[model samples]
Target chain A: MEQLVSALLIMIIGVLACAAYFYASNWLLDVLFPSKNKPADIVAKNIHITNTVRPWLFIGPALIALTFYLIYPVIESIRLSFLGRAGEEFVGFDNYAWLFSSDTFYQSFKNNMLWLIVVPTASTFFGLIIATMTDKIWWGNIAKSLIFMPMAISFIGASVIWKFIYDFRSGDDAQIGLLNAIVVFFGGEPQAWITVPFWNNLFLMIILIWIQTGFAMVILSAALRGIPSETIEAAVLDGANSIQIFFKIMVPQIWGTIAVVWTTITILVLKVFDIVLAMTNGQWGTQVLANEMFDWMFRGGGDFGRGAVVAIVIMVLVIPIMVWNIKDVNKEMEGR
Target chain B: MMAVSSSRSSLMWVVHITVFILVVMWTVPTAGLFISSIRDKDQLSVSGWWTALSVSEQRLVARSEHPDKQVFSSDGRYEIRGNILEHQDSSITKFGSSSLRPDEFDVGVVAQLKGGKTLQVLENGDYIYSSPEQWKGKRGKRIFYTANIPPRFTLDNYREVLTSEGLAKSFINSLAVTIPATIIPILMAAFAAYALAWMKFPGRALIIAAVVGLLVVPLQMSLIPLLKTYNLIGEFFGVGSKGYIGIWLAHTGFGLPLAIYLLRNYIAGLPGEIIESARVDGANDFEIFSKIILPLSFPALASFAIFQFLWVWNDLLIAMVFLGNNEEQLVLTGRLRELLGSRGGNWEILTASAFVTIIIPLCVFFGLQRYLVRGLLSGSVK
Candidate 1:
């Protein structure tokens, strides 16, 4: 009861404090830097809206929001990573050392690697196929929309709809779980589909694929449609068959788009939590780093240190990809 | 022939057929959900909805007082003069009324009983009974009638689902989280993106790189740590640790880097001419962004909003972390997830909940979808 009350108290006070801080910062800015540009244009010279100050003003609320929610947590996680389960006592590099020495963490890291490789590739591949095939059809837009419909469903929702598909019921009076019913019809034993470990990950991957294929298709479709018609015609005149044209002309032309599609799916795969939570809850060797963190923190009686280490590791893995993506964008820009 | 002007014109039919097949393939599961939501629960159990339009033979149990009890008499025996044609008045359809004489009747005729009783039945549940004696005994026995019911449709399923299902509350919860989650990120991202795109500063590249670097940092990686941070700060400031504001901030933080990246790319790609001209006209960055860049970059804004809206609306993890699981605070996604375990087989509730969750997204998507143009990149690329 005291905990709940104190938490509430903290929320109200934190908000008020943050507000006060912002106001104080603004005042400090006013006192610290007086503009020397009285001769400036009306738009630029507005004392309240200088180009230098305005951007920060625009950026201020967002920065505070991120700081409390994201940046602070990232810092705190690093601090907590070395702490024990009590969270009061500090243990230096123990969590980091545990990660290198621990088999469980290693296995989880391996599984995540497999998921990252498999999910993005499959989604992107299917997306490319759908995009290319539909691009030629007259009702392409409608077809694309149908495939994209699953994208509207939350990950949890998709997991549910897929659950019925993968459902296994013990041989009951009717074998009502759909997939098991089919297996029964074929005179096979019903299996607990989600408990099947690596195979279950594939099942989870299907849900991601179902939702994301449309995203991949849509972006790639837009890029496909954007290809200059004359370029394709010219390729055809040069004795390229349909397959050759697709491979040589189309693929090369849309490389930037393909890269974008791949990267976006990669980003989504990194944060995948809902499907795992909804379906397997990261049990039976299907645990990814993200869901594992939740297990350690919330489910496993709040192991903040290990959870933080996993988070830091994820950040390390993802930051480089983000940098690579940025570099790719810069290159795409420079190439253009 | 004009048709021969196209060598494979005949194959156009083939192409159309193939495309139609694919469309049907894509549409079947969705169609199944729609049909399952409305179909009678009993019928839904016995057969798939593809048979919804066909007459279904259903065994309807009814009261069958002895036919003699169904009749009324004016005179005693020898009242067989009137057959099933003129007696009681109620219409009965393709199903014969009696189990013993299941096939004893024809299209529109009734039959006479041995005890000078007459019964008439029509195809529409109208029936008449006449007998030489007064009726006696309670409803005789339970009668089974195999009635061929024509296809029936009702809004009752939806009514039951939306009202009693608790989906309505969850739908609102989802929106509460979603609306703020959607708004805060775009608001932040737009400003950050503009700064990154237009504002000159030291370490601009580094800041963007940091943000981009932040992009891959999975929220799961930071989930526990973030919660701890919130708790600590909440402690100092008297805030407990979790709430809507916390979730919104989390969503905004998670959403910010991408929003910044996407919007910056788009804003940066804007014809430099416009920003340059605005600058020359002495317009500051905000005015130029608000007046010139925003309107021109509608496609980007719409796309990003769609992505962010759908994402936050569908988010479960952040909601689980920052927001308490209390009924009032539980978002739609979380609620739907809970329902998946408890009410998994209740197709009506599941479909209705899904539709409720998706309603806003569909609205947002179709609404802004038009702004997703073909060639926003054309001017930028060239």
Candidate 2:
């Protein structure tokens, strides 16, 4: 209880301190360059100076934080990739060589490729189908919300939920888990789902796909709504079936939005570490780049060199999407 | 949508059925966890949650009364009588004296024992043992029965996890991390968003573009360098590297780009005349912001708050990296992961703990999901 109270106190103080800084700093800026009740020329000069300075005042703290946390880290990580474990000595390309030569790194890379191919495509496909079907139904909102509920659950929580489903009991213990129960009900042997080598990767991917389908659905549902009714109406009048109208007219129009949802889930799949970490911790041939990176970060009192190399690999994969996102935003901003 | 053909109506049935199956598929996992959390711990391991509603059959062993409790009947025969079931709600279906065939005799049947002793068991669990001579055994006879136990539910798992599993502490820690992390980013991002939107400053376009790029940078890229920076700062300041303040700042830094982007999109879409009129009325940027822009952008701010709150609350990687794993600082997700590692097979503990960690977000998601969806629609760059 005392700890809670102290935490509450700290929270209030922290927030209030940020508020105070913004207010006080802006107030100081106004005080330092007073434009009121001054000579007209001096007032104009003060207005110009404050116009330039006050925006900075509003933006200063955010800029400093973004630079320190994000921009500088990107550069420092790239530099550390070329350095030694403690990051004090330079080891040019040694970490990269080791990363390529290691069996575990190869396994992680292959698994990551599998995840990249499976998670996004499956999620996007299910999302599109569910979105289209649900829009035609009356209870669509309830279905959408239920599907979207998994998005709110943490990866660890979802792992636990799915783990309970995949739980195994040996030697005719009535098969408590739902999966094994069903398997035994159908006269099949119960297998340890997460321990299988190649197939277990698909099992793990199912959890992610289940969690992400809702996100894709929501976004794609919105995009489906954005489709012009006239086009669909025309398609229907042209003797087109529902499927034809959907694929031929509606989906093509929302291709951009579909791409957006696809890329978003793709980015998420790349950064997915918690599910694997909590579920298997890269065991059973289920390693991925992000989890492997996390492993190296703390494996032997912190191997900063190899960890940064893995991070750079993730960055390289993300660069195309990053470039595309910026260009899309720039194009949209210009239209605005 | 209104002009569907009659043939499509049959297809609509297919759609409804398919959607029903999909909804059940999505909802049953969570529903199972919720039901399991409230079930009797003994029944939970033996039956699936789908069967939680019906009576569960169990093989239970009970002991008959000892010979000291025997009474002399009117005919001078010794008899012992007692109820086997502790709870009257359960009914015994079959009984036996050995473990090999626990259901050797049907209820209400009399089974003859050695030495002219006969035992009769009833469905309601009442049993009678009769002997012609005086009963001499000190110990009671062991009787096994296949009993139909009623469905039972309790909140004991929740109580145990909350009180003893350290979830109660982690709940508070999650709040302490989430609330400030949620609020601080809103304040900082609202100001920055306002600047990027209304104020015509140099390089504003570049900054906006940069924010978009940063949106996709994998957090793995930042972990090592940030930890190094934290360690250095901690060395200089004589504090632990992993602390709440450090994590709060970290969440804020990560969340700011989205916050700014979402708010900027909304704020820029607001009627520009309001800010212009306020400016013409001799109001400064600060005045126009606090009184006008802030109130008008409440939906965006709220949506971002919900996002940041859920993100910080549900985050495990950040919590594991940025905060200590001790009871003082472990968030719910971290604690749940630890529990998953240690008590991997204990379903009651895992289910209860996982439900506790997810319950708040589920509530918030259900309550403010409209704003969340709206935020996502606008937050994603078209």
After best superposition, candidate 1 residue B287: deviation in angstroms?
A: 4.4
Which structure among the candidates has the greatest TM-score?
Answer: 2
Residue B46 accuracy (lDDT) in model 2: 85
lDDT, model 1, position B368: 59
Query: Model 1 - which docking category?
Result: acceptable
* lDDT per residue as tens, model 1, B195-233: 878887656666766665666666766677666667788
TM-score, chain B, each candidate: 0.74, 0.89
Tens digits of per-residue lDDT for model 1, A1-336: 443354455545545654465455555654454344555554234554455676676566766666655667777778888899756689999989988998778877888788889988988887787788777768878887777777777887777666755655453544434566677789988888889978888878888888777777777777888899999999867967667888888989989778777776787787787888888777887888777777777755778888788888778777766677668556654664
lDDT at B126 for candidate 1? 43
lDDT of 2 by residue, B1-382 (tens): 5546656788999999999999999888889898998998888888888888999999889888987999999977799999999889899999988889889999999998778888889999999888899878679888899999898889999999999998999999999999999999899999999999999899999999999999999999999999999999999999889988899999999998889889988999899998999999988899899999999999999999989988999999888889998989989999999999898888899999999999999999999999999888886636
Candidate 1 reaches a DockQ of 0.32
Interface RMSD of 1: 5.4
TM value for model 1: 0.77
